[model samples]
Target: MEILIPLTASLVLLLIGYFIGTILEKKHYQSINDREEKFINLPSVTMTYRAASKETDMSKYSKTQLVSGGVVVSIDYFKRFLALLRNFFGGRVSSYETLVDRARREAILRMKEQSSGADMIINVRLETSTISSSAGDSETVDSIEAFAYGTALYK
Candidate 1:
């Protein structure tokens, strides 16, 4: 009975911590999304258009390359390391995957929104980064940034 009481207390505390962390992290995610939306809606004026590939003579179709200005956004959420640690014992680190996916999608959607009159975008690339650490570690501060780019073409 005595051991059970302590174990129960530990479990309760763990649950409470998780709940609080989730709430805070959600709020942070919302904030990041808001900022990204604004960036996507911002106007982009094109001065010159160029293609990276020079296969003009080889290809039969005429292609106009549309390049979107790349923007890098730092991850705004806190307590991510704690969440990752907790994930090892729990099911999985859902939050990390969710955040990464969100950033990639938002970057692409925003680029499309900013660049108008493009038929298709090909060869999309995503780059990941953190504020302080290059890689995520147990005792390291958790921060993430995503860089997304693609070649937009007009047919």
Candidate 2:
């Protein structure tokens, strides 16, 4: 009976986490899509500086400023449990993949938002970070972060 009580509690927590996490993730993706549409016209190049402004002359750019954006995304307990199972079975954990994707897109949107007035963004770059909780020899992923940066030019 004692073990049954703890097991039932854990199952309840897992269900709550799964439902809430799904709702929040969907909402976040919707917001990302909306913002992406708003900034679709702004050009952000990930290549070198020359490639970005190759056609346009440097004189056309009157000012240059560095812009950056970062976002952190945490996983739900249910997803964590899924990941553990996948680790044991040795297969893809696509549930975790969405978290990283969301963070990357959100970071880019934030960078673009910062440069809304600029003509273009050049030399864009993205960096990712992973946070984990390590207790003794066991390590579990807690969250992930994505950061985007670029140079914005204004005429």
For residues 1-155, could you state the per-residue lDDT of candidate 1 as single tens digits?
Answer: 78899888867766775677667557756865776575553323222233324423324336646454344433323335446577679966665676666666556656666546665555556676655554656446454566666666654
Q: Across residues 1-155, which tens digit of lDDT does each residue of candidate 2 receive?
A: 78899899989989998999999999999999999999998988876667766778878889999999999999898998888889899888988999999999999999999987998898899999997767644646579989999999888
Error of 2 at 134 (Å): 3.0
TM-score for each prediction? Answer: 0.48, 0.92
- In candidate 2, the residue pairs with backbone N, CA or C atoms under 3 Å apart (3 or more residues apart, or in different chains) clash, namely none
For each of the candidates, the C-alpha root-mean-square deviation to the true structure, in angstroms, is 8.4, 1.7
Scored by lDDT, the top model is 2
Identify the runs in model 2 with alpha carbons over 4 angstroms from their true place: 135-141
